[model samples]
Each structure stands twice: as C-alpha cells, then as structure tokens.
Target: MTADRGVSTVVGYVLNLGIALLLVTGLLITTSGFVADQRHRAVEEGLGVVASHLAGDLATIDRLASTSDAEHVAVRADVPEQVAGRAYTIHVSPDGNTTKIQLVETRTGVTVTRSVHTSLTVSESTRGGGSLRFVYDDDGSIEVADD
Candidate 1:
C-alpha cells in the first residue's frame, strides 16, 4: 500500500507539471499575437498623425500665400524621417484646386492620404533627410524647392 501511494503521488506531480507547462505555452502564444496586433495598430496610428499634421501645415501655407503681402513666400518644412519606427515615402497628387498627400510605408504597404483644399498646388518629398523648402509664388502658386 505504501509503494502504491508513493507512485501515485509522483504521477500526480508529473501530471500537474505537464498541465502547468501546457497552460503557460498557450498563454504565451495568445499574448504574443495580441502584442503583434497592437504593434500594427500603433504603426497605422502614427501614420495617421503624420498625415493629419502635414495636411494642416500645407493648408496653413496655402492660406499664407493668399493672405500675406509678401510677393514670394518661402518657408522651411520640418518633417520627420521615421514615424513609429518605420521609414516612409510621400506621394503628392495635385489637381486644379486640391492637393492630395499620400504617405506610404517603405517596408509595409500601409498608406495614409489626406486631401487639402487650396488655391495653389504644391509638391515635395518627405524621404529621410535635409532642410526641405517650399516657395509660394506671387500668383498664389506653391512649389517645393531644394534648401
């Protein structure tokens, strides 16, 4: 009876150990997936913030061109290279009266586009580095220039 009791005790402990490990593994897998999902969401959110910011800035520039007394308005653009740990490229689509700014992630295909209503159309690149410049002409036209 004593021998059987010891063997059953050992077996019970082994079973408990196996169950604990299995539970831990399952929990780790679930947590990992959630973390990954949150990371993607964070990246997209960052892109949205950048897009909104640039759109607002461009709108202000357009207004400055229309309202300012200066014949030619020149301003420097302060832009970041990476948003949320990812590098990106910008695509500007200018129509007769509207400017569409598209920020596309280099590695991922995540893209955010913003359309700004303006009297002038402008173009610029937001890739990586340098002191970017923009010039608004007397005729209320805007153009991106190398600074």
Candidate 2:
C-alpha cells in the first residue's frame, strides 16, 4: 500500500509538469504570432491614418486656394522615419496634373499612394525629415519642401 501511494504521487507530479509545459508552450506560440500580426497591422493602420490626413490637408489647401483670397498657404506635417520598423519614402509627383503622395516601405516593398485633385501643377520632389512643408501659391501652384 505504501509503495502504491508513492507511485501515484510521482505520477501526479509528472502529469502536472507535462501540463505546465504544454501550457507554457501554447502561451509562447500565441504571443509570438500576436506580436507579428500586431506589428504589421499597426504599420498598415498608421499608414492609412497618415494617408487620410495628408489627403485631407491637400484637399483643404486646394479648396482654400480656389475659394479664399489668401496669397499663400503653408502646412506642416510630421514625417516618420520608419514604417513598421522599416525605412520608408514619401514621393510627390506632378506628371498626371495631380499631386500623388506615396509612402513606400523599403523592407516590405509596400507602397501606398494617395492622389489629390488639384488645378495647380506641383514641383516633383522626394521629401524626408522630421517635418514637411507644403506651400500653396496664389496661383494655386504647390511647392513641396522639407524641413
């Protein structure tokens, strides 16, 4: 009877250890995947927020230029050095008679472009820094410069 009792106690402890190991492994797997998913989601969401903000700003500038009597309108924006822990670039192009804002993630090879309708032609340039400046001329032209 004593021997059986000892054997049962040892078996119970072994079973508990195995369960604990499985639980820990499960937790680790879940957390790793959650971290990965959250990382990409955060980047995509941030890019989207930035895109919308820029689009609105550009559109507002266009409206102001057309409707208001202001000579020039200047706007500043906060630029991020990395998107999802990867370097990115912002491009403003004027070839199509519309200003296109592009955010490209170098590591992931992801590019997001937002096109804003504008009557004025823009000077094409690559912009980078802590902040950006958008100057709208009296004639409705746009000049993009970084600071």
Candidate 3:
C-alpha cells in the first residue's frame, strides 16, 4: 500500500510541473504579443507625424507652383525633427499642376504619401504598406490610391 502511495505522489508532482511549465510559456507568449502591439502603435504614430509634415510641405509647394513661373523646380524639404532618420522625396511636375511627396521610414517599414491638386485646392494623404499612387482630377480634388 505504501509503495502505491509513493508512486502516486511522484506522478502528481510530475503532472503539476508540466502544468506550471505550460502556464509560464503561455504568459511569455502573451507578454510578447503585448510588447509587439505597443511597438507597432508607436511606429504608426511616428509615421503619422511624418505624413503630416509632408502634407504641410506639399501645400507650400502647391502655393509656390501656383504663383511662380519657374518650370521644373526642386525645393529641399524640411522634415519633422523627430523623424530625421527617414528619407523623403518631393516631386513637382513641370507644369506645376500636380505635386507628390513620399516619406519612407526605414526602421518601421512604413511609407506614407501625400499629393496636392493646385487647381482644385485639394490634398490627399494615405499611409500603409505597398506602393502609393496619386491622381489628379479636373474638378480639383486629389485621389490617393494604395496598392
């Protein structure tokens, strides 16, 4: 009878250890997921700030394009101080009817685009994965398409 009790006690201890290990693993996974989510949110906020600054710059470019007669003009853009690590490109068509700006955040892999329609006084901005497309309509509104 005593032998049977000892074997049962050993089995119970082993089962308890297994359960504890599983619980610990689950907690680790949950914590990892939470950390990942926080990081993603931070990246998104940073990208949003970059996008907003680009939009403001594009608006300035649009105003210049409307008033100036200079063809094929290139202006060095000033980005937000917080996003100094990212690279930005601003393109102004020769006609000055359309302007497109692209911001790429290397560390977070986030890309944002903003475009302005000078004739219509409309601006469109979008953020996400993949390539960005900017289309101008005759009515003066800008269209942003993301692929």
Candidate 4:
C-alpha cells in the first residue's frame, strides 16, 4: 500500500503543476490583448494631436504669407519624429475648397485627418514626420515638405 500512496502523491503533484501552467498561460494571453489595444489607442491619440498642431501651423503660415510682403516665406514646424515608437508620415491634400492634413502611422496603418483653416491653397504632398517646413510657394500655394 506504500507504493500506491507514493503513486497517488506523484499524480497529484503533476496535476497541480498542469493547472498552474494553464492558469498562467491564460492570464498572459488575456493581458497581451489588453496591452495591444491600449497601445493602439495611444498611437491614435498621439497622431490626432500631431495632426491638429500641423493644421494650426499651416493656417498660421497661410496668414503670414498673405499679409507679409516677403518674396519667400518658410516656417519651421517642430513636431515629434515618432509616435508610440512608430514612425509616421504627414500628408497635405486639398479636398475641394477645404484643405486636409492627414497623418499615417507607417507600421500600424493608423491615420488621423484634420482640416486647415487657410486662405491660401495647400499643395498636395507627403512627408515623413519630424521638423517640417511650411513654405509659401511661388505658385501661390502653401506646401508642407521635409526640412
């Protein structure tokens, strides 16, 4: 009966280990999804803020370019190079009479768009995120490009 008792103890130990392992695996899987979702939200919010700031900057440039007598107008915009550890691109596109600034995350494909309240027309362009230049082009349109 001693051998039987030993066999029962071993079986119980193995079963306990299996249950603990399963519980840990389950917890990891659940938390991993939550983390990913949180990360995506962060990226989206970050991009939105960036887009708004860029739009505001574009508007400011438009006003300055319209009022000033300077032949060449260039404004430097200081923006982050990366959002949530991901690189992104900035796109300036004209939608009919309205101008839109779109920011797109390279890896995750997250995108945010904001309208620029500018009197001057905006030329369509795409540039990587970083310090950008808003130039009053000779063609009488605002352009966003790499610095």
Question: Stretches of candidate 3 above 4 Å error?
Answer: 61-96, 105-109, 118-147
Rank list by lDDT: 4, 1, 2, 3
Best by TM-score: 4
- Give a tens-digit lDDT track for model 3, residues 54-105: 5564565456555665443333444443443344333333235555555565
Per TM-score, what order, best first?
4, 1, 2, 3
What's the lDDT for residue 73 in model 3? 30
Regions of model 4 farther than 4 Å from truth:
none
Highest lDDT against the true fold, candidate: 4
The parts of candidate 2 lying over 4 Å away from their true place are 1-11, 63-73, 78-88, 106-110, 136-141
In order of listing, the candidates' clash counts read 0, 0, 1, 0
lDDT of 3: 0.55
Task: Give TM per candidate.
Answer: 0.74, 0.68, 0.49, 0.93
Q: How many backbone clashes does candidate 2 have?
A: 0
Query: How high is the CA lDDT of each candidate model?
Result: 0.76, 0.75, 0.55, 0.88
Whole-structure CA lDDT of model 4: 0.88
lDDT tens readout by residue for model 4, 58-113: 88888899998877798888899999998998888988767989999967779999
Question: What TM-score does candidate 4 reach?
Answer: 0.93
Tens-place lDDT digits, model 2, residues 19-59? 99999999999999999778777777767667667767777
